[model samples]
Target chain A: MKEDPFAIKVENVSKKFSRNLRRSLFLGTLDLAKSFVNLPPDTTKLRKSEFWSLRNVSFEVKKGEIFGIIGENGSGKSTLLRLIAGIFPPDDGRIVVNGNVGSLIAVGAGFHPHMTGRENIFLNGTILGMSRSEIKAKFDDIVKFADIGDFLDAPVSTYSSGMKVRLGFSIAIHRVPEVLLVDEVLAVGDISFKRKCMERMEDIRKKTSIIFISHDMRQVERICNRVMVIDKGKELYTGETLNAIDFYYKHTIAKEVQNIDPKLIVYESTGDIYNITLNITNEKGENTEIFKHKEKIVFEFNFESRSEYQNPILGLDIVSPEGITITSLKNVIFGHQRPSIKVGHNNFRVILEDNSLMPGTYRIAFKWRKQDNFSLVSATGGRFAIQSEPELVPFGGYFKVKYKWIQN
Target chain B: MEYKTIYTPNQRFKVNIFKTWYIMFRNVYDYRELIFQLFKRDFLMTYKKSFLGIAWILITPLVGIVNWAFLNYTGVLDPGETTIPYPAYVLLSTSIWGLFMGFYVASSNTLNAGAGFIMQVKFPHEALLFKENFQHLVNFTISFVIIITTLMLFGVKFSFLSIFFPLTILPLFFLGSSIGLIVGVINIVAVDIGRVINKLMELLLYVTPVLFASNTENENLQIALKYNPLTYLLGVARDLLIEKNVQNLDIYLIISLVTFLIFLLALRLFYVSEDRVIEKMI
Candidate 1:
């Protein structure tokens, strides 16, 4: 593939932040005291103590390419954008841009509360490096796009969050920068406005390169031509959008499960000389099928016990990647009994049908305990990837609904 | 390919003061429309909420004249000995003083007002400050017009030399802006300087010959007051308005030259520390 010429070059860029928030005043005083005492400063150790938010992270953004940066929280995606925007100088390495850059890091960031929308538009335009005449030429288009006709003359403090975001987006898009940096600004505003902004971004991408940072995986997939996944200030993967999201889930979610201590999985209860094996099956009743949206999943637990107890309660739950409990099941509600294993094996199965779930990955967990004491007996879990089948699902997510449009 | 030859493999970041100033001026020029818009917004919005509207501009100086009259009546000020009526003297001093104080206050706080823009946008950091200070200049010009009309109402003689007031203010404006730029940049890294500047301005009010005339007989005080550029500026304004004589042309020229040099020096310091200081502070 031919490189479209590097519009922005980030070479070995690393940004170090002072980890010690308490050191601000103390460092100032220390510097003062050092000069007074005539002592050699320990600047070397202080520099080393700083935390690197982005460490030797390098990437090239081609002209007219929409580059998406996907990551979990605190993964330095916003920091990278700030660095490229020249908000701060990199402690080590360099970032070079070939043309003018505009950033929409946060909606309404530069808007003054006392200034009216009309005033803020010019102020923000100037701040974004737009000439007065340039802003004047585009002023009407900006107001029209924001859709806040009469309110433009009113103070920005009076504008709603959606209104603020719309005006901000309108001004940023009007700037016509050679490189545009956007950071999760689309998460605000209504759905229609979001679509409008997406379309505007698409239009701008024809002439300018963009670096978009967002936590919304689907949105990234929809807009970005290539996506990069960052984890713990390291680049995990950078390539196709789908592959990056998959790598992110695998490393951030699955790897977390992989790191769980085996000893932590043990639970205390009645001493039973037996073992339990958990198997997950999809709606098709196939052993290989993991999970699907609105599809039933069966948890088959095969276990053996040395002796029978009075009652044993069994529970199962499906947890999302972020540890959100999507759904759970308990045998106690059904008044089920476990037959004596006689030092052998026994099988128990629970089926969850038509599970209303969002199209994302999930984990299945199993738990068993004595009925009276409610003490844990054993617990285990395995990974399950819940997906939406393109053929049947209208939209992939937790909730399913239908809507009709009428042409008037 | 042509691309291979056009795209250099290695390019270094160099810090050039002249280049930085060029960028700063280019950005300010480009954003001139926004500056004018903000100026108009500030000018109109200020008078919008007032009960008297634009008359407040004349009304403020009239109040000051009335206060001076009371002071003179009580012998706090000697009217018979002064070259001009107490009201005219007070009006001239206050008009020029107001311009200086307004520019000083606005320029010093320029960075604070545009902090968000500086952090988010890729423009000359000083443009925001300059635009804000320029707004104060417009306000001062408006108020000066009101003062001149009031002076005429008082039956004071006016001459062509009075036109020099605007030229006289240009040097003072640059001087105040230079000081403001330095203080504004310092305040970005350390907020303590902002508070200190307010307190320092208050202290300067008493020491400077704005409210009270400095006695020429006191050799020590005269020399000290001469050292203050603001004193010379106020003296020039008073001479032009009241005495109708130009005093110390060389001093005014020296002040102008010194101010221009300082402004250039401040601009250089700002460019050099632009990335290192503000980036760390913000």
Candidate 2:
């Protein structure tokens, strides 16, 4: 089979870092001396306090692809970008880039404070690998895009941070590098500037292959053709953006559950009298920790009782992270107080045709009442997250609404 | 459209001499504009918002000359066995010494000043070192004018060889920059090394025949000064400019050869360690 060429290919690469900076420097110098004699470093051995920051990480990005990388801080995302940009070499494996690479890893990185904005445009442009002629040609456009007007001739030290960032970004994008590495630089500047930058990025994406590292999942879902999720220097998932997001959610839940004490979850319990378990799943019957907004969901509760009871009531409340109730399901609300509940195992299922809750984590709390008002058991049933939809506005206020407009 | 980029872990001190040279040369060649811009920045930023502005460049050498003159006037400093007058001798040597010292310190601190850029951008960091050292040339040129004025005012027989004096100091520039580059790289990882270099520079100024002529009666001190590299470079530069002494030209040329070799070695180490060391710094 013939191999299809990739725009960027990172093969089994690994990087080790040490926490102790002084010792790391010592080791680095030792390595430098050894390399002087053409000796290979001892990759197989781990010295006193060194750890692999990136270990055996591999991925391929196609040309004109907007590849998204999402991870918590210190997940080797920056390291990967630095390696690809040739800012630094990897410790092992190989990364192949066929075209010139550029990075907006940090805006205003090479801006000299005492230089005028125009001078820094040339300065930073050249630092980003733009030739003098390229900057000269784009000089007017860059200045206009930066929108610094009269301040172009003023020293950068006199320019506001926003102006500096604007100038830096304008110069970078105008260069139109073949492969662009963006590292959360969009978080800077004001809203209008951000919008303009996003538009420019969208336009650039048509011609340039980009590796975007962002914590903004919304941006990732909207723009990325594919997404890779990483945690603690390991690849958790790499595929469709939405699926990768779901995997990330589950991964987070698994991590959170590690520290949870099962005993603390039982508020009141008579283990010999009642046993209960709850599970939430999507309509397909497969268990899922995340559900889309307005998607059908099933909450199945399994209860086993040693004896019969009259008028036994169960209550379920879907509460927000701040403990405010968004919605609830109570057997009493429907005026159907069960005449009696027989002994032995019993199952209760609540189906919501459309879970219209907002996009956030929600806790499902459950309580069992005996007779009229005696609370028997109360505990958190489960937790699930509603993933935001693409079309909806990222409403800061809670609870998405479905309403129709009337024309008079 | 497919472009391949290979990234591998920096093997323990892997020395591919040719590859290192190629990488450094290519990056420097490609980013020459940036290098010039950096030099421009250093030059402009040094004088920005300062009340004295470019006058600050002359202050260092001027201050040294005044102190030496005051000491000689008070009879506290003894001038023994000098080819030129005391004031002229001290001023010329001090100015030359100032140029070398500026190159050394500026080269050593170049990366420190641009640590933010080096950590974020993947450009030839050697450009920063070269820029910082190059900026000192402007300062040296300023001091050169002052030295010329002093030579004429004092009625010293300044030779046409003085025109080639700047060329003679080229080897000192290479030697100082090479040492500074090595020390600067070390300073990034171990900041204490910078302090050590600073202290060493101060101590060496006293030992080198910069402000005071060598005390030949003290055999131990004379022997130490004889072996001091700066002592010879300064002697060679002074001879060509003031004394027209060419008897030891062979020794000066030999020193230039050794300094050039050291510069090549330092540059190689710089290329080999740049990426890894800089990444670690970030």
TM-score for each candidate, following the candidate numbering: 0.76, 0.80
Which stretches in model 1 have alpha-carbon errors above 4 Å?
A1-4, A20-49, A112-123, A131-144, A148-158, A254-315, A319-325, A330-408, B1-23, B46-59, B72-75, B79-81, B157-160, B216-219, B280-282
lDDT per residue, candidate 1, A1-408, as tens digits? 555487788877776556664454345334333422333233323353466677777888888899999888888888788778877666567778867778988765667776889888887776677777788999999999999979998988889888998998899888887889999999989999999998999998988899999977778878888888887677778887777766665555444544433222445546573466677776555774335556787877776777665566667877766677666787665545654234467787788765766555666665666656465465656666555343332254554545798999
Task: For each candidate, report its DockQ versus the true two-chain complex.
Answer: 0.19, 0.52
Q: Which CAPRI quality tier does the interface of model 1 achieve?
A: incorrect
* Residue B37 of model 1, lDDT score: 57
Interface RMSD of 2: 2.3
* Docking category of candidate 2: medium
lDDT of 1 at A276: 68
Backbone clash numbers for all candidates listed? 4, 19
Alpha-carbon interface RMSD for all candidates, in angstroms: 7.7, 2.3
lDDT for position B64 in model 2: 62
TM-score of chain B of 2: 0.87
Off by over 4 Å in 2: A1-4, A33-40, A253-354, A362-408, B1-4, B11-19, B68-80
Sequence-dependent TM-score of model 2:
0.80
